[model samples]
Target: MKNKIFFLSCFILLSLTSFSQSISSSPYSLYGVGSLYDSDFGAIPSMGSSGIALTPSNFINNLNPASLGFMPLNHFMLDVGGKAIATTYQSSSKSEKRNNFQFSHFAFAFPVTKKSGFSVSLRPYSSASYKISDLKLPILDSNESYYLTAGGTGGLNNFDFSYGYRFTDKFTLGISTALLFGNVDDNRTFTILNSITNIHKKTDYNGFRATIGSQYKIDSTFTIGTTIKLPTQIKSSKVQTVETVADEVLSVIESNTPSDVDDYYMPLEIGVGISKKFKKALTVNFDYQKSLWNDTRQSDLYGDFVNQDRFALGFAYLDEKSNFRKYWDRIQYFAGANFDTGYLEIDGKRVNNASVSVGINLPIENSLSSLNISYSYGQKGRISEGLIKENYHKLSLNLSLDGIWFVKRKIE
Candidate 1:
């Protein structure tokens, strides 16, 4: 079991190092640093990404790191997963479709003591991939027209570490530190009378991020959790190049060496959640999250970064009285839904998004391992606001493993 865990870890690290590129292709990603990546993993994805207040059990909950303090002593857990996405974009008169597949998340957690724990993980911070070429304008007072084309790719990555300590059987606190780094590439081209000019820009990012979390048990059946992510800026360098195109041939006309740009701002975020258990047969969770983007004083060229909020409700159920001999009877079923007022303000309206999800956990034959699968259908933006609308379907898979890391052995 240990060997298998080690192998999986190495494979994920190698894959991440070898394939570094954008994982999404939505036009909404063109704003700010790009569309933000989901921060939850494991069965939580099936549960509307809302497990912040749940006590740790077979799976590790990273949504609220403080929950780690409840892990069983000497227990080690690991989760690795990925997702596949298909999306269709629609405007007032046209539509396009795109597909993508990419690694989702990787994490490892271990208990330091009966009341303390630690964990580490690697997850995507954001993604940027888009192409636009539908603009045409008549040359001033001339019978000629020009076209504008724009596209971008690349994103940011986050490496995080967390530690949690239990103050009592009912309360826990945790802190997390993250190293953020990545790069983004943006390009634009203008064409007129068979002549084309292109401008390309690249930005490299590096920064540190921090967060704090806490959880308090209100009763045997209810618990409350909260988290706060502090605002920080990412130091970056930008490189620009200009090229001229004629007769299908291109030549670089000018270029700017990479130079430092004013650091980009990241907004503060806060989240709160609650979990309720009903006699072990069913559990329900509710979560609310907010990003204070309006206070960041940052604005995109085409839109404003406004305050963002999300609400989610989740449920899990199992037949506790079912025979253990039946594999299907022992399985857990989960379902959820979420709604969001997105961070981008375009055409005087904030982009809105919503999704519904369902999933199940399949237990391994003779090991403390389970395979989790989830599916979600979502939509973003509205066609009535002079904006593009996006509809997407996503599939996610995760392998959750539990084992003992070390113990004393006795021999005769």
Candidate 2:
């Protein structure tokens, strides 16, 4: 109880010390919020990635309780998923970059109530990990040149807890909540073509999150589910920022006092899905979801104006003689497709994008564990009517461990 109180107190203290401010600044992009939470599940050609509203039969979604209804009885679930990426910039000769190990997430789940369960998970909310360096044309009014190199990593390390109850043999209700311990660390080097200054800032914000959803069996052959997510608020903090004036020299600004000003809101997300059983051993699932991104606002630095709406379809089948490992055979394959259009507008202009993803379940450790790998590639274009696009590729691998942990005793 004392430890609990201490952690809570620490969170509250951080909440009261941070404030968010965006002056016309390039490092401002560091303040850019929201894009890092996109979960593509690593399947690119079929189920489009990008946090679209869909759930395939995978282990990671349990971070939000809406995903727990899919687990089986006597089940103990464990998951670790990570990504590798190769990013290329096509417009500028100096734009090429690579981040082989980009992001990762971990999760665990187990039964708590009859036909009900609970779980916890942690994952990167939005990655501040990036580098930006560009030279501007001569300032018409000033004789100075602008060159800034800055980047940061970390945001909203989320911890989730959830409970799911079976209301009937065919229906289940799920409610899950999350507590985020956010830290965005940054370092910047600024220059006016000669003089340079380097500064760093680390800010922490703590907040609460929640999601409510339910699943129902339409018949012996099909099932469906939906969830409504509540918005999460990250307490304010004074993060490091740069302010550019007509003089062209970059400068760091701080609050006159320790101010609780920075606040981040993860918009409400709503989603629905359905699964059909084609045979005793074959089944298919499909889902659609929309996140309230338009309802969220951004600072000049957090440029992802695109909140997302997504769609997906996944399938599972039992293998020959059920020899694929009882657990591994339960998930034969998964495929999906997604579409994305963000809320980012450049003076009354908006651009749209889409993609596909696919993955397979490879059984491991006598079926007690399995390795699921997925790959995705996509493009979002029409940047501010300049037709700028970010064509990207991502590969992901997730390991799932599921089995029985305890057994109840009976007496005559």
TM, every model: 0.89, 0.73
> For residues 307-364, could you state the per-residue lDDT of candidate 1 as single tens digits?
9999999999887778877877878999999999999997698898999999988776
lDDT of 2 by residue, 358-378 (tens): 776655445345566677776
Q: Which stretches in model 1 have alpha-carbon errors above 4 Å?
A: 1-22, 136-147, 191-196, 244-253, 384-386, 408-412
Q: After superposition, which runs of candidate 2 have C-alpha atoms over 4 Å from their true positions?
A: 1-31, 38-60, 63-70, 92-95, 135-149, 187-201, 239-260, 280-282, 301-307, 316-331, 347-353, 365-368, 381-388, 408-412
Give the range of the ten consecutive residues with the poorest summed lDDT in model 2: 19-28
**Every candidate's CA RMSD:** 4.0, 9.3
Question: What's the distance in Å from true for residue 167, model 1?
Answer: 0.8
